[model samples]
Target: MDAKEKPETTSSMPQRRPDCIKCFDALWFCYSPFHQMQNYYRYGEFDNCFGKWGDLVDCLALKTKRAAEAEEILIAREKAKPHIWTFRTVDEASENWWRMYKHLVLMSPPLPGAAQPPPRSDKS
Candidate 1:
């Protein structure tokens, strides 16, 4: 085809398919209309069933990962608390404490974007 006649391509090309088995499994679980419709009522959207499910699954997976990361950070902070010097002022520590607590609460399981737990590796 002539350069002038070549099809115009945009930067918003579709993404490549995910290779992770967990992601695929999550996607499969989301494909059914029964599930999608229930989720639609619980969440939102209707017409784009499969796409919506895929998006939900992906979001869940990311949320799970982030939650896990946040938990680890919390643990590390707790472990280092003794050695780490804190603010001498009560208000400073109180503010920091509340911020950390809020983050932990937000990271807890079932939080929005929290992914369903992956299947146990021991299961056959």
Candidate 2:
């Protein structure tokens, strides 16, 4: 390298987004209430059960937040697919709505540009 000359950079590696790896890894254990209930309540520790339930809810919320973020990326990648306007039946719509509600509970303000059902028009 000469004076007044910048050194050439070799790596053009793109920076990766910071994923909460530890959170994802620990979620497998944290979300399982079976172990906690078996070990704690079985030993007559009733108070711990309530606390454990709270902990589990928090963990689930964290997992959902991460999943919603990943879902956005997947949706973008699948944009080339034809977009359907309505559900074929009420049962299918209800099921999908329930799933979305659970997954996006912690996702504040909801996702932008999300698809909405067409407004119903009364012919009467």
Candidate 3:
């Protein structure tokens, strides 16, 4: 055998995943439709993949060692978001926008400390 014909070995091959990305990819795959459907057909429900989720969480927490703190912070941030912050259809979103800022809409009081504009004319 010649040098050009040398066989490749595991040590010389590139790794499928060399970082935390592997854990993330595995977690995503666990949540994919194909995997979930297969699991559902066999087990009547999706695979929880809690171990994969834990692996990714652990991998990320390795950097700051603050997994619990991070989860709390995320939950707090979610709770602090405005009602309009969530995604909705155009009609649904545009409707009832006033509910989010009812305080700002002084319909009854009608323009405090400011003069009312001139009324519209039919001419134009």
Which one is best on TM-score? 3
Please give each candidate's TM-score: 0.24, 0.19, 0.35
Q: How far is candidate 2 from the true structure (C-alpha RMSD, Å)?
A: 16.2
Model 3 alpha-carbon drift over 4 Å, by segment: 1-18, 65-124
Per-residue alpha-carbon lDDT of candidate 2 for residues 37-116, written as tens digits (9 for 90 to 100)? 76576676533445545545554554556654745654565686766874458856755675677556545565689654
> Model 3: how far is 99 from its true place, Å?
63
> Better model by TM-score, 1 or 3?
3
What is the lDDT of every predicted structure here? 0.59, 0.55, 0.69
- Per-candidate clash tally: 1, 0, 0
Give candidate 2's error at residue 102 in angstroms.
52
- Tens-digit lDDT track of model 3 for 19-89: 58889999999999999999999999989999998888866765464645655655666579897857888
- Which pairs of residues have clashing backbones in candidate 2? none
